[model samples]
Target: MKFAALMRSAALVTAVALIPATTATMAQVDGRAGPEFAKLFAVFQRVKASYVEPVEDDVLIRGAIDGMLAALDPHSAYLDGGDLQRLETMIDGNYSGLGLSVVMEDGAVKVVSPFRGSPADNAGIKAGDFITHLDGTLIYGGSLDDAVAQMRGPSGTSIRLTIFRPGRDEPLEVEVTRGVIELEPVTHELGAGNIGVITVNEFSADVGADVFSAWQDIRKEAAGRVNGLVLDLRNNPGGSLDESVALADLFLTEGRIVSQRGRARGETILYDAETHYRGDMAEGVPVIVLINAGSASASEIVAGALQDHRRALVMGERSFGKGSVQSLLPLGPDAALKLTTARYFTPSGKSVQEGGIKPDIAVPQISDPDFALRQKYQTRESDLRGHLINEIGIKDEEMESDSIADPRFQLTADELKDQGVEDFQLHYAMETLRRTTASTVALRPAKR
Candidate 1:
């Protein structure tokens, strides 16, 4: 399963323009009081004569504007002329960079996650890595934009990163060459028992078509033997909202998938799954959705919709709460504004803002003990208050479960332990799929 990283912008303020009537009033007041203009002229003359450092007046004005804007939320930001142009190119998905997603935490830059099949991922960069130095220069207390600028360069150029990872005794050094990171929207494989596993990394521009192609490939490979489908959404930070809706519509035949409510009272839009792509073989197949802490935004949209409609059973930790929709507003030249326009809601009218989607079966991931000894796992089925939607009167069904001493999903205990498969989550998912498929098939009618 591939994980997609969601890139977020640091907070700043939106620019406000003075109205014409207010400008006229200010001009009238200034003209009536010649003393105020005289005072300004005297101060300017005094500053010009007595200033110690040579400073440009335009620089001071721009600095003041920047300072004012930075006080707003971390998402709003101000971009200089060069940065504005680069942002324009980034929005078009064409840029040369290290292809890493970063965030500001504790006044330092932190790696949230690396894009799948990108330079950073290939370089062995992992999530929760703290970047202390970029190209041998200390990046602490620096602006995120400046750090990003240092990371981005011409294609085929190499950049060195000094990172600090948890559970490591010493910091590690990785040198990655910049490249044109083409976003891969979807990837799939046939799991054990011919179970179709589709990993939607992100909802990119061509994701809808890519998902369709992936489903076709899975169907062809299964040859009518596919008993279950596992939609892996782990660490998938969402992208385009429309693509998410379209992807959800692929499996669902008819029902309210998701809904969005803007700031206004009655401003709401409901999305439904209308088109049916799956035939008899595809319908009624047991679906197991995998998610984690990094899964957010559009990923949550699909997860919440499926869970609410009882279409798929979610398995993993809670998702990242990012249920808001942002609209890109062009500010002139190469500048733009990504404003939070509305809050999204699941089909049950539950808002996921600051509250994430909880799985039907809460499985705690095992990331410790060196894989030698047996590790205990916890499954939470109680009603958790922080869940996006409330689980009402739903009883946990008795499903058969299994475990492998080894880590590989397809390998048995002895084989996996020898091969050293470290992905405990995938192993657990595979077992869950087997158990669910058996239970589903056992309940079905026996053919004559």
Candidate 2:
């Protein structure tokens, strides 16, 4: 099994999948738990001996393991043959399938987001689209793992998808051919006014280095000093913790990046800036970070760190709140225990478990015609079954409450489309940077 921390927030249904953590040794149970173990064994024996159908020992054992983990939190799970294989494939960063990230919402397979250039994205399988069938077979109320297995196949293969979009009148039938999903973790572009836009798709391996290289390339392309930067992390479910700290370190000169606190001795860790990189790479350049309901885990770490330090002006909807860390304990060569071992906090000692990282500026995605409908169905960490509760109590009503409306955002989707504004959030961020004098948005030198 991969001996790394799997910090990606949302559950992935595509070939790109969740990561695993460090190996852990099984601890001895206390004598006080003997009665509970005895009862479990009794139930196991009764099911095996008296059931009409003979139940396999492994099946029962697996079920018990799954139930135990599920009771704790949604992120914890038992990973065996197929699950471990998927983890390996995700780590490898390439596979053949309709690239998508999905989660099981009340037994229905709901699309989180399609990988940027994958077959699903190309075929218009958007986030919030409920996939009810695969190849005309009803998949509602089915296992997410089974549905994912059905969706993936050899490259060049095609599968029919029955999608139920939230505001659509009827279910749409679409056929998409599977292709190789090789996700580029970091992608950059030079927009107007020498503004460099760096989009971190995921916190995969060496993503910090990639972003540094991207900045260099953007500077070269501009042939002059870059005025501002937009770090786009919208729809980005996270990855490695190390990568997140590294990415945040690029723009921060000093101070704590994030701190992990857990019950275990070694689980509590403090990550700070200047440990990975020497100093701020974009020292005096202004930065604006973009996030939405889809940005989570490692993504939140970067956003929270930068926001707390006033390194960037975070704009967009509330993020997908996921502050816990999952450590993969190797049970065997083919299996491991993906357990939530710690809850992480931002530099200001804020936990983004239930409430998530609130943006410095709340900019709605009014570019989608179904924005209201999509927002209604959009799921976050708090929406998941058995999610970790925040240490500081955060009410559900408060988290669900809409941000105050701004008259500046009164433009309709149709109007924006006619005006050639493909992405409203990006447009707003770019426009804000463009209009601002460079000094106002420039990074303040670190105190320490």
Candidate 3:
């Protein structure tokens, strides 16, 4: 299809909030800052004149640009060359590599998560793994885009990755064969009790359309009206703002899905149901959204909207709060400015800035033995240095706590295994659907 240039506010923030692209050029430095500029220039002159080795102008300029944006927020950045290309590739969603969503932290390339069935995931790559090297060559201290470019190659090739995983005794190496990554935005699987598990891997272009198609397929396989749904948004770093809104609109017959506010005239906009899709596709079916720390940005938009509207009961851990939106304002042919232009709010007027969407039902995944370890090391938008704080202040405890006590999810990992619950979170969601009537599916004690 069809596509448009949108924002990817990332480093866990990845919702390309929809806004009209402006022809506005970067304004000239103000006369008021002439003194400041002179001082900076003076420093530059001294360095160039007195330093033993000469420093290039491009190097100094790039450093200054990066430094300015870095101090603003973790998401804002100056994009050029490979950085811009990588962003284009994310939106395009088709490439050659062991597919993974990654970010740079403290000068190391960290795995946000592997695409569910990509070569990376197939090779047993897990989220939170720090990729230390590629093919025995150290990649730490390099730019994230450079690391990403090195990992990619033509299909059928193999690359060795040296990973340093937290809670592990030693670093590990994994060999993943290259594959052409076809970024299918949505995937569905029909589980027991006629439960449709629809996973939104990313908010790439036409993700709403993809989910609609997925629902149709699930229903066809179901051979009847699906009783319930589990919208899996786990490990989704995020993508297109239109796709996120469109996806939420599919399940909301009427209501505000999300709203973005910014100082600029173009940044303020509201998305509502029927604005993109006609009506609720899964209107009557009870819905449970699956999210975790990896779920962010556009992921939070959908979860927050559905949760606020009572259209779906959200489950799993707290989402990676990344409510801000980025806008790609072209600086020139070779470079662009990726700026955090707006902050989004949910239907209930709650801002998922540093505090992400909280699931109505807190269900933990006790299936993976590494689950506890992952939680300890899991990163979120709030965890990022220089991340924007919510306008409405929040306490540290609110962001830190995952769950209190819930007897329903009190089952141990071994207990869940005994019940053949390989995926504890999804199983719990589906089981809840099977056991409860849709109207009374609240997060209270189980009814007799």
Candidate 4:
């Protein structure tokens, strides 16, 4: 994503008040919106004249702007100076915070997913948990920015969170210390039998280059030529769309990677492979992509593209369905508008809006004792209010199929722990790749 680059230009913020217009011209332009405009002005005048106390024009104007956008969708928002700086910081610098991706849902701050290895993640903050209070203060019906600000503090400082988990009977209280969140966008490991595991935490700047370098490092650290590859995107909340394209292009040679359709001409664009990278990075290696409820946006883009082309076997829980693309339109020097501009589609013309990417092999993280409980309450894009609906309707049954327990995957966490399997999903994926030979792996597209 060119989020940082988009902040350089100044954009015009359209206001409700018009300069001067004839009644007929205004009627022709806005389909007789004079009465609607009159109502809005009347409300503003009444609110200004009669209230508990006098409210500042700045506050009222900002509230009006926020209310207008709130009526449209959840993703669209007015970003003030702090919001812009925070977005930039998340992309390029480190900050001391709980390191959790959260969104306001019905005025409650709900955790999307905690960053892997962050303080919140270590504190056992799971996705779909609603944070009700911070430091003993009830934060219900508060702005998301304020809740986020309260959660962030200097390193080593502790904050108490009152969380209302869905299935739990009582509200859970947990204390967590803050730390500097140094986002490791791309991480790699050399597994046994010359298997390489590249875990993409987020699609930030230079992620494609980082993954390429990771493959080099894994090859150097390996005992023999690389036999298998695993691209782990679990709990990755996504970032730059361009980086997602670049990452997918690393493995794909030639095909439509993704396409975005929007009202504007510029928003509609088609991305293909052999553009960012020349050829497949791991040409003949058996590949598997791991995703879960926390994988969204750019993560879904990469997973959907790879799965559509049959480049990798996607194995994990269904992804967080987020097909819409948000474009950062700079409002001024210190503010911006993050507006949902387009909906992206996979190569198969599939929109992962409400119904997220379904894994080819549904593998639960049975290594965690709380897997069943967490999975039951796991939130996806469909859980968000005013979220974009898929152009094609989604079946309730389609979304529930992954939750069904399979006899082959009935191993309990304690049983897996006794067998030394800390992560059952990854362990299973690596094992599947190990037994497969290079000759059996198809680097080219299979016949339809």
Candidate 1 wrong stretches, greater than 4 Å: 1-72, 78-97, 105-107, 153-157, 166-170, 177-180, 264-267, 275-281, 367-420, 438-448
Predicted candidate 1 versus true structure: per-residue lDDT over 279-323, tens digit per residue:
223466777788876777788888887777677778876776666
lDDT rank order:
2, 3, 4, 1
The 0-to-1 C-alpha lDDT of every candidate, in the order given, reads 0.63, 0.83, 0.81, 0.81
The TM-score of candidate 4 is: 0.90
lDDT for each residue of candidate 2 in 123-240, tens digit (9 for 90 to 100): 9888879999999999999788899899999999999999999877899999999999887888999998999999998777788999999999999999868989999999988878
lDDT per residue for candidate 3 within 1-448, as digits (tens), equals 1123323322223656433444543455578999988988898888778888989988888888888899999889887777766766765668999999888888999998998889999998998899999999998898887889889999999999999988888999899999999877788899888989999888876788889999999889999678998999998887777888888888877778899999877778998778445687776688899999888889999999888878788999888889899876555455667789999999888999888988887777888877878778777777799999988788658665754666675677787788788889888889889888877552221122
Q: After superposition, how far is residue 199 of candidate 4 from its true place, in Å?
A: 0.8
Candidate 3: segments with Cα more than 4 A from true spot: 1-13, 17-25, 275-277, 399-407, 410-419, 442-448
Q: Clash totals for all models, in order?
A: 5, 0, 3, 1
Error of model 1, residue 54, in angstroms: 6.0
Tens-place lDDT digits, model 4, residues 64-141:
888889887777888786566566667554899998878778889989778888999999898889999899999999
Winner by TM-score:
2
* Residue 21 alpha-carbon offset, candidate 1, angstroms: 20
What would the TM-scores of all predictions be? Answer: 0.70, 0.92, 0.90, 0.90
**Candidate 1 deviates by what RMSD?**
9.7
Candidate 2 segments exceeding 4 Å error: 1-27, 167-169, 399-403, 443-448
Q: What TM-score does prediction 2 earn?
A: 0.92
By lDDT, the better pick of 1 and 4 is: 4
lDDT computed for candidate 3:
0.81
